[model samples]
Target: MNTPLPDVANSELSQALLPLDWVGMQGIDIPLILDEPGVDASVHARADLYVNLPMPQIKGIHMSRLYTLLDRFAEHQAVSPASLVALLELMVDSHADCHSSQSRLRLAFELLCKRPALVTEGLSGWKSYPVVIEAQWCEGRLSLDATVDVTYSSTCPCSAALSRQLLEQAFIAHFGAGPVDSNHVANWIRQNGSHATPHSQRSVARVRVHIDQDAEHLGLLNLIDLIEGALGTPVQTAVKRADEQAFARLNGENLMYVEDAARKVQQALATRFHASDVSVTHLESLHPHDAAASSSRRGTLPFQAFDKALRA
Candidate 1:
């Protein structure tokens, strides 16, 4: 005689006759292979996978099934737009008992890439960009949202203007009333060229874009390039004296406020992606608090929800 295995989920009955909007797993650690093309990509991503439990009579959805489904997907498919959509589809299909109508998956990981020094020949270093990809299938339509966190330097325009004013006063005091000799003025400037340098601080920008459903690829690298390029002052990877000088010139030329940085990113993303949300935070060197601003394309995404998603 042989013993039969028991299926607890199939046998169990619900204590409360109510359905849950989302029920499954949260923070499932998994290894995701990213096929970004021409790169050796691998990430240990923390994923939140869930499906709506719409059957009130069922005790609970197949929790083990949900986990196994995700596991299978992770093992077989590389992380991409098409794979994500297919995984969600499988997740919803597996929960046939609950009649699951919607599924959501969120993955958080850091993407590493080699960045070349701004001015040094044959010099490069690695940089990590924190990324989050969220996919949802509801009402028979799938939506993909991606967020990237990029760091850069921002010089305060107001602080730069104030520093210029102080320098002008200092120059007037040194040069005196009428026409001073050119050699004397040049000497004074050489002595105090940076008498009043503007205050600059390291800032972070979080950009979220709603990608078109049915997009061939996630386009993570391209999105990153566009955002970093728009800002024009990404934090460097490898730095020599020349590289540092180049960085200083960049900061001096692209002086902007927190709001200006946000709008610049928002406009650039809107032009490229057509729908995006941008939020920038300037960790001020002079002030104790940080300066921040957020913007979104009109009617693309609700401001409150988009801001919350950025924080999440």
Candidate 2:
């Protein structure tokens, strides 16, 4: 006769009887199929899946159930708010024996998109965007949020002013006396235009939007375009000489600091997402440390302020 395997998790709890908050796994490798526009449908993501432990007497929750449920759900449907709601519901149902009340999930992945050069019509390349999707099912309500990282160029206004002053001083010193030849001045400027170019550096903008649960689409591409357009200096790919020159002109025109970038993205995104958050960090070429700034919606961010706090 074959003896049934032992189930130690069902044994009476000898340890503390207090209920635990969250019990599950983190950094589980998973494949995600997204249906977002302008982006490919397949991606690899890292996920943190969890469910609340509401029963004090239970030794441990069913860990394998969570993994298998997630695997089955991901293998069938595309990742989205509605699908996530269904998945969390399944997770909670599967943990009913342990008296679980809620479920939460965090998925991190990179979104790839093809972008065209600034000036060259035929030249284009792919860009990778790091993103995170968080969802929670509690009290019969589903809440979701999407966060994206956008890269751009930032030129210090102070540094640009200083550079201009130096260039002006150089021009005056080059022609101390009057009656400077126009051709000589033009040639001189062409030769030394970059003698005092403003200090510029690549920067990243992290923006999170509290998604409407009923919405079908995430609108990530639109969000990216809005922020990138507002900043006016999104990093480029597949650049030719003309494209590079156009990018240079754009940088010269759109001078900003970390605070400026944060506010710009905040305002631009506000038109679409009322409950959102924005933060930007400029890796300064002149300083040893990075400069960063943050901004939020008009009143308060809905997700991090209320829903996230309650979850904590």
Index of the highest-TM-score prediction: 2
How do the residues 176-288 of candidate 1 rate in per-residue lDDT, one tens digit apiece? 78888989888998898899989999999998888777777788888888888888999998899999999999999899999889988987887777678888999999999
Candidate 2 residue-wise lDDT, 1-312, digit = tens = 599888899866848888888899989899989868778778899989999998888999888999998899779989877889999999899998988989999888998899999999899999999988889899888878888889999999999999999998999898886988989999999998778989999999888888888888777788889989999999998999999999999999999989889888888887887688887899989999999898767433337553342242
Give residue 226's error in model 1 in angstroms.
Answer: 1.1
TM-score of each: 0.92, 0.94
Structural RMSD, model 2: 2.6
* TM-score between model 1 and native: 0.92
Task: Give the CA lDDT, 0 to 100, for residue 117 in model 2.
Answer: 98
Q: Model 1 off-target regions past 4 Å?
A: 1-8, 38-40, 181-183, 298-304
lDDT of each: 0.86, 0.87
The number of the candidate with the highest lDDT is 2
For model 1 the local lDDT of residue 272 reads 71
RMSD of 1: 2.3
